[model samples]
Target: MSQSIFILLILIPLTFTQSVRGKDCVCDLKNSDPAFPEKKLKNVETSALQCTRTITSEKMTDLDRLMLGLQQRVKQVEENVIVLEKEDDRNLYGAVSLRIIELEIAEIQDLLNKLNRTTQNYHHLSVQPAAQLEVMKDKMAELEKFDNMQVIKTNRENERVKRDLEQCKEELNATTAAPPTVLPARCGLGRVVSVAGPRTYSLTVFTSYTYGAWGRDAQPAPGDENKYWLVVLSTSNVYGNFIRQYGTLSTLLLGIGPKDTYISSTNPTTNTIQGPNMVMYGNALYYNCYNTYSVCQFNMTTRAVSTVALPKDTGYSNKFPFAHLAATYAYTDMDFATDESGVYVIYATTSNFGNVIISKVETSNPPVLNQTWSTSLHKRTATNTFMVCGVLYATRYLDQETEEIFYSYDTKTKEERFDLKINIKKMQTNIQFLNYDPRDHLLYVYSDAYILTYELIFQ
Candidate 1:
């Protein structure tokens, strides 16, 4: 009786121990804890079935190869079906029953049908888990790249803020030590105003042009600094009709009342104001000349013009004037821009080096290049560019209903941010021209036949 009790105790504990070890094995895998001791056991198909979701590039490649092999097999089966269709019971199976031959052919046909169906489904299966994950991985990699760029950009901005704070302190000290003087609005900086206008003013001087510039002239009359001037870049009108009037600098005043007319007295030719891009500063209008690295400055005061030659090896030296719309993507090799910091000519270098180069205008008979900032971002990536507070903002198409502020380069910080991603509600047509006025902090955009204005609130 004691021996029997002893055997029962041993057997019961042994069974219980096996049960506990089995539970431990399940717990280890379910928790995914590698620190747990590995249980030596078999028949774990349930866990294997549950862990079938892993997908990698190598696995996807193997899947693609398998799909290709299956396609080849399908093709082979199709060829066999053709061969079977030609086979005659009398010749191939002389002693075989006709019903047996038909059964064999039907079996082959059924197998071929199944293979074809499987072939059709192969793409759907491959795309769902593997191809979808591949695309997701690519997007994640791009996001990581942007994150690294953001870190660098943030560090640069911090240093710039520090410098600006010190400069502000110095300015405050100087102001405290000196006499105070107040400046009037006329002496202050000029900016674009948010004027809601679907109002169409006829182009009396130059009827139409695909690519041209129009902006508020620099104090046209003594107190009329807000008056705008229209300059046509091409003779080709909106309908593709060539007009001779656009051969000259078609400068017109834009406003109501008496000053709203063409300024024909200072008409210019190809020697000046022929560039596709133009910006007005003070009493002069600057242009990047067509098919040349020359910048023309047309003076509204004296009706005189001066041409400034860019470097001979400038990448955009002999390029044709930019078209408002292109077959594929919009390209702007030279864009004359102005902000509170004054006027600047933005262009790409000869070698390009995958960047746009900005040259500041200095006071000279023919304006001299003061300073240059080479943005590390490519020029072809943007549709239009504008400057505000010495920072260059570039736009990209985001769809018919939206446009995105995709890229920016701060001259002060020397930092480039390629993923600003600020969405601006805009029409989808090509944005031919973009100009920012600093006085009122408004962005003037020209797309198709519409002139749109948006208020830019700076923080």
Candidate 2:
């Protein structure tokens, strides 16, 4: 009985403990602080991170090489383009000369095409091996670059240039008969008025050289044998000629020529005089020798010679009979003009007041002086100031001074005259410069054998 009671007590306690564990196994281990301890995973994580780093590094290296290759390719392309451009320019050396060569080539090609063969060279028309190769290369290269339309366009441009060259040559050849260096009417020109019309201009130049006389019964025609001729050449649009011959030294218009070379007479043309300052007026070839200043008109339409009055001197003749520029001088050198009034011929004469005298030819009495203005202001050269709305611009020379001064003459309310700050340095012996072209309001100054221009800011 005692053994049975003891077993029952022990067995009952064991059975109760096992039932609690079976009901909640995790809850039953409440006495333990942690269910599972933290683990150590260093090796696997470290290896994966290292692999990622290696992949990034390899990608960076590959990208650098790709960039380098791209830069080299671009540089190579640039160098090749530069070389090609230089070769093109080298091929075009003396490009203007190519025009002439092209003409010869075209003619040769025509002949060769007709005969189905090329020609052999002669002494005058010889071709070297190198020359032939160069021509062939140039022609083939240029032809390859052109389409059919481009070829036609190129041909047209060449033909136009050729035609222009011929016309320019013809005009240039005609000037051998006269001495006035023909300049193209361009931007740098000042207009000197001729009573012939509005578009006429004055030509100013210096020339020298002389002969004793024209006819048989002449005196020892005198002055400086040093040869200087100051002339008043007039420009006229009527005859398409530059000089109308307002006045000249005795020789140029009346010099001895081929048929009458027996010391008979020396005259230029037998023409007629038309209008004032003898602008655009041509003369018939004078049969006999006479004074150059005594002239008349030559008409292109009617083509006749009529007498015009011998102009009263616009003074300035103290040291007159300008010996040097006898047959070749421009009339505008001693004249004044404006768009409002026609023109004024000013001269410092021996008889008249040294004050300015004007020829008002545009009035009722065409030959009379409209008004006599006596502004006794002195000038450097014998040339006078042209007045526009009472403002004056005159060229003058001081006897002892080296430079020619341009005087801007104006008066205050009390008629007090003043000068301005405009001047040009002409200190040298003067080798033919300063021409006036009205087409452009400027002066054509030739200095140091180069053409320099000054524009007239007309006030």
Candidate 3:
């Protein structure tokens, strides 16, 4: 009877507690509501708006802006090319055209770099919420396609411009005839003489000048070597002197005298600043400037001078105005020479396996580098170089009286001959510069302070 009473007491309290809890839960539920679905909807709408704004801002700030700039640059290049094609003077044309092409190339490279960055940005943004970024991805894909097409177009145009430059060079080269395979036997140094006058200016560093017939067979009356055409550098300007040859029978007179001197109105000051290496072809005087790494030309008729820079890293040592006997063999870096074909610049290059680089100067007024050849032999291996036809003959001195013409490079055939052992007999002296006069069939060599001419008597 006691166990039944205990069980009744437990059942009555459990029932009463259950009824009170139900009433409390209903009262709490009616007091407030969480509204989770409404909060979620508001957050999603805000995210979508943010994504749309970002897409619009990025489109304007990134790929679209770069593409617009690229288009403008390409258009400018095309217009410049058209203007260049119409230019009559080769000097101005080549300079302007090459500059335009270079600018275009740089622009294309910049655009490519920007595109690469844009591609990376696109990938970064791709991992964002798919629903919000889907449109952005599509837009980016289209921009990428457009940019690729433009890049390809610019590259093709760049190639076309390069081809045009080559065409211009070919046209210039065609203006002159090819040189002979073998030169005459009496085509070397000859007589030496001196000038008679009062020295007002110094020829100490007067390195650049032309010593050749102005026109075809333009020689002074047989023995009238006293009065001749002269273009030499002075302290003030590059003066043209028509003076008399004087001094004793043993020593040859050189340098410009005080009489009959006139400054080259166009190129006078340009060449005077630095000692240049010069050559004469027909009516034009070609030279390589020391201060500037450019080959310059002076038109004898119009008195106009133009210049074009040499290829980079060609080891052009513009030191000491006069020749240095001590460093003559060591720093024998650059020399300007002319053959029957045209003018050429010979120098040792640190690049291209330390090769001797020979570049042909086209007939353009500024002189363009038409064809180039790299010799396996080092340039300093020889004391001097003279181009015969298109072949380069390197001379190495054995002693005061002996020089071995042991190296020959044929630019046309691309052949190197090391077995050639032609011996040249001369006094032991540093030969500063040498030129083969096609008109008189003699080699003019300048050594020490004397100008000597020799006859090239080949066996």
C-alpha positional error of residue 207 in candidate 1 after TM-score superposition, expressed in Å: 7.3
lDDT of 2 at 83: 35
Model 2 gets an lDDT of 0.32
For each candidate, give its TM-score against the true structure.
0.49, 0.30, 0.44
Q: How should the candidates be ordered by lDDT, best one leading?
A: 1, 3, 2
- Candidate 2 per-residue C-alpha lDDT over 1-459 given as tens digits, one digit per residue, 9 for 90 to 100: 346545654433222222345556331112222222112123334544554554453334333433433343344334433433443344443343344334434544443443332222122123343454455556545543433336656887999999999989988988765745533221122322211101111122312111110111001123322121222112231111112221121122222111211111212333321111222101121110122322333332344444322234533212221112222222222332421333233433334443443333221211233444545553223333444333444544333222233444332121424454444444333312233324334344332222233434331
Ranking by TM-score: 1, 3, 2
lDDT of 3: 0.51
> For candidate 1, what is the TM-score?
0.49
Residue-wise lDDT of candidate 1 within 1-459, one digit each (tens)?
A: 346545654433222221246436321112121231223112233333333554344434434434443444354345434544554534543333344345445544655565566557555555565654555556544444434236656887999999999999999998887755523212233322122221122233333445555656422446555355555444432111111211111112121122322223233434444434567677677776544677767666675667788767665532422332333232246788877667888877656563678888864677888888988766666667788767788777767666677777777777888877766666535556677776655566555544454555332
Error of 2 at 134 (Å): 67
Q: Write the per-residue lDDT of candidate 3 for residues 63-92, one digit (tens) a residue.
A: 554665456556645655664565455464
Q: Candidate 3: where are CA atoms >4 Å away?
A: 1-269, 273-276, 318-326, 329-332
Give the 10-residue window scoring lowest on summed lDDT in candidate 3: 193-202
Top candidate on TM-score is 1
